[model samples]
Target: MHLARGAVFSLLLATGLALPGSEGSKHHANKARSAGYALKEPPLTTPWTDKVGTEPWPEYPRPLLQRSEWKNLNGVWKYQNASGLNAVQNPPFGQALAQDVLIPSCLESGLSGVQADWALYSWFSTSFEVSSSWKGEKVLLNFGAVDYEATVFVNGKKTGFHRGGYFRFALDVTEHLVFNKQNELLVFVHDPTDDGDYVIPIGKQTLRPSHIFYTPCSGIWQTVWLEAAPVNHITQLDIDGNMNGQVNITVHSSAKDAPAEAEVTVHKDGKVLATHNGPTNKPFQFTVPSPKLWSPNSPNLYNVTVKLDKDEVESYTGFRTISRGKVDGIERPLLNGEFIFMFGTLDQGYWPDGLYTPPTREAMVYDLQVLKKLGFNMVRKHIKVEPELFYQACDELGLLVIQDMPSLRPSQSKHVENCKSVPILPDEKQQAEFTRQLDVLVNQFKSFPSIATWVIYNEGWGQITDYYPEFGLTDRVRQLDPTRLVDSTTGWHDHGAGDFSDNHHYANPQCGTPFYSADSSPFDPSRIGFQGEFGGIGNNVSIEHLWKNQAAIDSINRTYEIDTTIEAWNYRSHILLGELEEQIRLFSCSGGVWTQTTDVEGEVNGLVTYDRRLARTDEKQWQADIKALYDAAAARSNATTATL
Candidate 1:
């Protein structure tokens, strides 16, 4: 009874160019899809869904390390579903798939144009001709992300396979590619969403989704594109900077054995500020004289370009520092050595239509803009890694980020049920796989200045509690990236490690003390505590905006203690923030994060509605209340500084 499809079209534009086999090439299709594609109606959808067009997320997928020449491969493509690994041992090859699916979207989402029944595996096939300009160059087939496992085939030749669901992967398809010809690109994805057989980090996804767990995001839920690069190209740029204005840049080149000089240039407003040349894969530093520091009040970023031989890539970084220091006799996280409280939201990145993916680039930007406009300064990206574009938006919008590593647990979470603490020691294979993914995550996301802290575990979801000063989880993360602050454990079962003694309370806010000092010391200023999560004020602002699934209904029914009216929700939220202000002044609380930014399916306690159409509170009053927390925090910080 609650659905709207104002400009939303129907679902499939199945008609397209054929590939290489079966009475011609049914695999290859025209990149320019006609405006005749159909759209399916979800329970509630964002306005940006209408603007997605046939080419969803046409913007460049990777903004941090961008190249000029690239093609977005996100549109209608041949598709089919399978259940077993043996069924997909041999790819469809030259054969045309019976059904059509919108590329870069999982089959379960309405945006995919084929929200078919649940399947363990899927097959996608498409064909494209490489630009003649890129004929002699190495063609890198890039996938923004594919959930679980993905095996790619080009021109019927098995090309490459990637295991992770959240991190990005690229394969040099130059060998499998037939130059100047229409090459058929096929992919097979297998996602065991919380299957008891697999222990991969599923975050909040569950096959049997309910109140807390969300609908599963399987297959390619992000952008798929192709970028031309040289054989000896710059693969990654590890960038870091500090308060002393010294910027470190490390270039990772494809041709590691071959000697090549990495030429790095730092610029602002099209003018060069600093430049350095060093050997590839080795870190080198340069001081930016009179550096324009980056902060939430003024987010300033300097662009940089790294060139190695015939390959060059563009990147950007913000100069800021995160350190632990005491304010008003309570330890706090200092932003650029000043205690700036992070009035944040617990942002679980989910969409009704796209699931794991946002509708458009502008849509993602709007989420960050919402925080910026409302006087909130941070977002704890809860247990899910977003595309680099999300981080780029945070960097540009001046919103600090506390990024959580995805957790591994299938059934009802003990942490969510408020059960007693019990460390989950995963199997050896699970440990190795999780560690591998964490390594990639730390290496991948370290470039952004907006990420103030790396939260390893949330609510002890898939954590081994006693992982301090020993082996496995916590120590490995610190070993990989020590530049940023690390929260070894978030909600409960705190292992006395990492930077923060984080706690979670429902509808009320409270702070905790630091755990384990560097030298077994009593009081260490290098540690602090914060409210990881609090305040789930549920108010369904509009019936038309609610997700009408059974799980959603059950979730609403179970909210026996929540206030559902707009006025009551606002009143409760305001009072909670006021209490948190006092906590910041008296307790060892650095800041507090509201339970959520927007409502997910079923769990309807959000500042904004699920479709992002309505705010439960009056915008002006909510902004004023949030701003007051920072003012109180500043006064406490100022008093502490005077004593120092």
Candidate 2:
């Protein structure tokens, strides 16, 4: 709701909308100085826009292998932006070159009516009509994301091509359907904005935006449609719970010698406790009897169905564990079985008016219920990755998630030489589309139990330099989820593989070393630390919710204006909340997330403000100074468990 930098640059210079073609009319002399910056648009409604017509993303976006006789295929589509490959093989269709663009927003958004260009390659044709009850199933097609690359065609051949933008890709098109008439459904995207050679995590983007990057998101920014399945279903689901609570369930199929069976079940106040049937390619254990645990204050979820025979699928599960222990004697983080001190925020799920899509789905569950009503239990989503109903609303509103990986690298400096690299290594082939989009983001979020951690370079962006100590990219992300917790690199350059000891301080917040010490009878398994990015605190509150413009906001209001009122924004938010509560009481600080939670675009530091409708501090005195730093880390975990 905060967009006013002289009215969105006079509505993008009264839509003369340049820079997408004839070199956007040769950047009309730096288009009014890049029309006050912040430009990346494409996301036209449908995040479930007030039900009815233009069928908004009508739910059912694969809730972990679900299928209830489908056929949504969003609505109103027929875009155009071609640049070679023969204008996407001849497509000027029904003329009108512009207007009517809504299938899963993105065309530089404003509900994507082809807003000022950021397109690299585009052509999203459409024409539906096969739903005589999905005449003989198997259609499929889903793509809840498509930033980097995509290509699909039907009724003109070429069926699939996905190359990681942010995961999720499916295609079956039942032998190119043409059944009860009207077919055609072409698609072809190719983003590469930021020329960083892909693996895109150009967070706070920038072709040339300023201070903490801004704009630059490109091509097909999430959600596409079409569905119909059966001919043997449930193509994926892999849950794995432990911390001695036991729960492993794997079920994947697209008919690899068919003959698969699974039945699982496990609900809670909707009955059923245990069911379990086997063979869907192994692994199936169960046990919960007293297992509610899932944190950020009891998230508790269960309700999983699975069944395959008459093709049934419903999902939800949470048991939580996240490890690395030793509390008072240092080390840290250990959810389910204690030492829990992960206070949060660094979200970066931007949107001045839907930038990385989120105009609804209750504005992505009201930005995780306003960071759990500003008491934030956790969320370091930063390098962007959402929609799975935003981690199923952070596993049904209990938060706790670290999950990064949207990085491609760039951010290191010793006066710029090697200015942040990663131009392919790790057995290149362009790191095979970032290992096939990090194995479709670790198989659609490794059975999310409110993800615990999985950072993998941020601060080193795409890394690589002299093969950063023979990069075993955090042992290739612990061989893809040896069940969460892998912070390979969060800040600086520390190539000492995986698990904590990460650091990044700004606007100052420290904890460089010290896991434990007070006649240490615990803590200190090779010094585990993590500040992993500190405070930023900028506070602009709409300079056209600045991405930039107005002589770059009069050169950042004449170089960082300091005149302040409203009692100096509450004494600089109570002196940056007492210097982040003394860096969360020094010593063996096991938690500290901050560096964000709103105010994106020109990165105005944020503690809410870029349309989560303001809150730069004072949510009841920052929730009584974050409940007195969680009661001094619960009195140092009860005086280290009363000295054992």
Candidate 3:
């Protein structure tokens, strides 16, 4: 790790939020242990374990747009259930509360200290000392994410109101701050998982959380902090780099008339490569001489610095291109103008300790590291928008991402039963909210170079349109981000809207089946043919690691006829691997994604156990088979280019 990165980790440990004992940062390991808070119940933990104290995730949350002078607000805060009927509506802010809970981790999580049920409302209050340094500048209150809805108040004044749990938002709290004194910050949150009837886009969260659906995450599940910025600072920085060496930069000022011109400098290792000056909101184009393209093998990113009047922001971008192309008579996804095959596991991004959040920053990076070590080039982030640091880790570690918009509504029973896509007719209000949330999702993650595709919907999960065909939603995503490929729907009910035809196949273990085949012939050959999901071989590990023991085991047994014993599990996994290899060779699926990377709650169909233990398949053999698929794809690309 870099010295600066180590320093950040050390600081987080000192605050009792970050896990200690990371390599090169053991000096701060005892810091968390000193704070002393025992777990209420014995919990299943990942290999990376550290005693969480007052705060469990204290590191700077947003690495893409980081400010040196910022204060992490993730620590102990007074919390109380505001869901009780007639429970003191609109209570006075800044008042002391009885219960204490950890910030950033959701209330339902084991690490939060308050593993309360999913409530209609909850209140969080904390006090902080403002330094003399933040007098003149604006103190922007930033929340990495808040589930469903959040109403924030500072010093007894309403500072901001925000909706959507997956996207980051900020408020200029400069006016509400009590200068050089103790200030009070309070947040009220509410989340009705799936709007109680599958009307809202809930994305795998359920009140009863069973099978594929997991626990509901309400309240602040991500980081919250404060930063000093100018009154009219740069609000957003959008960067788009192409394989032709041209990069376009768009700077968004806080106010429309605030800044006329902004300067953008592109550099490599502190040396200036190119510079361009242009007006805000307009694309300023620059070119890097002999730009190094980003791919799974070589992920190169040029450092970028934007100066808009008094405010300056730092970012990075990689020069790459993506499209649908033909390889060996099969439609394939092309990266940087070359046909390449993608093989990855579906990463649900759920943890036993943190639930929706990772236990620590290192925990986030470890998941990607394991995937890369297993020789997979891509990961489909299934129905979850991870913290910015997760995406940044993917960029630095060289893993491609297919981001899915979290789905809403429909019971787990309905989703499981409706294997075919059922076109949903959403009301007017649902349409507006869905459009807004999708726009936020695209804009928030558009800058990451690792993201290769924007999945509009997953198997028509939470999809809504007036008519049978769903073309408008995919078109909206294209308009929001045209740089990446868009999968209209993955697995079932192809609308023929996006650039790929996706399929999902699973062997019925109940019939003692070894393999189930899927035909991609129904899809248009002009588009990329992808096996978005397949190969779910069940292997239930220990009882403690899963959500439920007998019930989950029985469910798996009923569905896939596989016994709970280790030997039986390993035998099926062996068979599944051979079937996977055969599918890659025989089918026209240019890309394939296994059922999952890790087991979740009731789902035992993952490469690794839920607590990230016990690999189901032999790692060496699996990697060799996947590598052969990649080698064949590359050879086809080379032969076709030579013929051209």
Query: Largest lDDT belongs to which candidate?
Result: 1
- Model 1 agreement with the true structure over 430-538: per-residue lDDT tens digits: 8778888888999999989999888877776776544442134567777777677788777766656788767777767765433332322232244676788889867
TM-score of structure candidate 1: 0.90
Q: What are the Cα lDDT values of the candidates?
A: 0.77, 0.64, 0.72
Lowest lDDT 10-residue stretch of candidate 3: 5-14
TM-scores of the models, in the order given: 0.90, 0.36, 0.88
Q: How many residue pairs clash in each candidate?
A: 11, 24, 7
Best by TM-score: 1
- Residue 23, candidate 2: Cα error in Å is 25
Candidate 1: where are CA atoms >4 Å away?
1-30, 34-37, 410-425, 465-472, 513-526, 640-644
lDDT of 2 at 422: 26
Compared with the true structure, model 3 gives a TM-score of 0.88
Clashing pairs in 3: 17-55, 17-56, 198-409, 198-410, 201-408, 202-408, 203-407
The window of 10 residues in a row where model 1 has the poorest summed lDDT is 13-22
**Model 3: residues >4 Å from true position, as ranges?**
1-38, 84-89, 195-198, 410-425, 465-469, 508-521, 548-554, 558-587, 640-644
| Ranking, TM-score, top scorer first | 1, 3, 2
